[model samples]
Target: MTFPKRFSNLPEYAFPRLRRLLDCHGPGGAPLRMSIGEPQHAFPPWVAGIIAEHAQEFGKYPPNDGTPELLSAISDWIARRYRVIVEPDSRISVLNGTREGLFNAALALCPEEKAGHRPVVLTPNPFYQVYSVAALAVAADPVYVPATAETGFLPDYGALAPDLLDRVAIAYLCSPSNPQGAVADKGYWADLLRLAEKHDFQVFADECYSEVYRDDPPAGALEVADEIGADPERVLVFHSLSKRSNLPGLRSGFCAGGPQSMSRIRQLRAYAGAPMPLPLQRVAEKVWADEAHVEENRRLYRRKYEIADEILGDVPGYRPPEAGFFLWLPVEDGEAAALETWRMTGVRVLPGAYLSREVAGENPGKGYIRVAMVAPEQELRHGLTRLRGCLFG
Candidate 1:
């Protein structure tokens, strides 16, 4: 039997590698998990009720694109949040989660060749792992662009050489980025949109953490594109109920783009995608329609932000995150910091290098640790204090 060569060079998924690295050592104190970004905040009280109301619908096959009501709810939320109008029926596809949408959009939209060459897919260095895998799945060249502090933690696609840009089929961007927690500003979005237009590429905007910011909502790529009159198909935005509604287990999200791009995505989804179960879709519908719970969720994260700032402030090289839940804390060495922190304090965190790929000789995330601020308030504070004492002291 022959295995696919595309994934042959890929490293083990982050969690498995982490387990191998830390599971052998006994935790020095009571275990406190600050590793994964699974939200510990309570979801809306009404979610269960809505799911129960539609429980019987689980027996029926869900609509591949989305139920009209669910689609309308998502559209309305987009209108309210980004002030961009997306046609519910034609321009949106409900996803099992944003992960699915993010991966499959590349398959659906990226061309086999661009400008008479094998296409390129651009991903931020410390990105959601799916982006590179998706590019490889399509046999496109996966270009890992550095999103380090020097670049404001957002990939500067515009800075690439024209030859590279011309071969780009898609560029994956995560605002309120996963490991770094950096939010791309409106100007950044506009510049990227213009670059995409000039180069003839699509922008896949992973905006899952859009709702978890500390101050004003993070500017979205779709909104910025709309403002600048960029081609509607130029940007595809993925959003989720996972972070916004504290419903990771629900696995509900949506992708919105232009009609042609969405049609292609929907066509692929109809053949290969697993639609959200109807009951879960009902929950997502209501979740998207309601913002009060999301606001409360943000409030909890805001408090955590304060706690993080208070605890880690005195530590040298601690740069506070502008948005998102993770703190990408600078360290002498990510793997060493992670192991030492776990051995000394039992507060588990992911090594930043696990989230990034080595480009040339350097992995941008090699000198940091990504600490999730997703634990409960008290536990999170305790973990941060112990982490500070262990790693920075």
Candidate 2:
């Protein structure tokens, strides 16, 4: 049998591996899932109405890049949220979800080779899996960097050897980072933009969790890019309505960057991209243009943050997330904590290690569990209580 060698060495997908680790034993009590970050709040009421109104457009093929209305809505959101103006026609492309855009952007922009070396794709050790896969798909060397409490859960690319940086092609950064809710600020973005300029690489900023936070909103990449006066091509930003509007199933998101970079992306996507259906695009236009639902969603997450602090505040090493809807609770070992929590309280949470790859003599997430505060308030409180009791009690 012949198989592509590139994918042969890939690790098992996270969930199946999780199943193998925990499914043998029955959950100790009624299940309380805090594993995935899927939002459980109510989507805006207008979604259905907009969908029904535009349902007739489904008879025609969706525009590959996105309809003008959809792109304009995204542009408006960007302008309002980040104070950066991107021409919807050239700088933005709608995505089925940020994940697809993130993965595809790597393929579209990563050079075939860099400095006569296999280009390196820099990724956080505990990263969204797609980043690594995208690097592999493009035959680039994926270099996992540590993003842990020791570094404020943000990868410090500057620390990489100079030789490595010279060959680096792209870097993936997540603010209000997944599985760990650390938000990168203006200074962090500034330093990164400077590094990108010096190294001549692009940054793929995953800001999907931008809307769920505690205090002031996390500073965005485009906002920082503008401050630095860097070439627009230097950075790409991906944002989604899934977390903000509680509409994950809608699969609507946008990626925006310099016109040249986006043009390449759209060119590739024209043949390969799966456009959001016209009906869905119409609904998304409304979703992006309206901030009421997003505000309401943030209020719900704020409540969860308060609940988490009250329950876990006293525990040593308990650092409440500044942004995003996750509790990256420090544990003795992520696997042990996850199994013990499951066995004793039936609170299903993912081991932080599962979201990470062992890199450069470390697995950054090995000593923590990432709990999503996405359940309803009552269920969320119950799950948090269970987690605290089992892990810290």
Note each model's CA RMSD in angstroms: 0.8, 1.0
What clash pairs does model 2 have? none
Best-fitting candidate, scored by TM-score: 1
TM-score of each: 0.99, 0.98
> Which portions of model 2 miss their true places by more than 4 Å?
none
**lDDT for each residue of candidate 1 in 1-393, tens digit (9 for 90 to 100):** 999999899889999999999999999889888889999899999888988898899899988888899999999999999899999999899998899999999999989899899999999999999999999999999999999989989888888999999999999999989888898999999999999999999999999999999888899988999999999999999999999999999999999999999999999998999877999888887889998998899999999999999999988888888899999999989999999988988989999999999989999999999999999899898899999888877
Task: State the RMSD for candidate 2.
Answer: 1.0
Task: Look at candidate 1 and tell me the lDDT of residue 154.
Answer: 87
Model 1 has an lDDT value of: 0.92
Q: What is the lDDT of residue 91 in candidate 1?
A: 89
Candidate 2 TM-score, C-alpha based? 0.98
Least accurate 10 contiguous residues by lDDT in model 1:
276-285
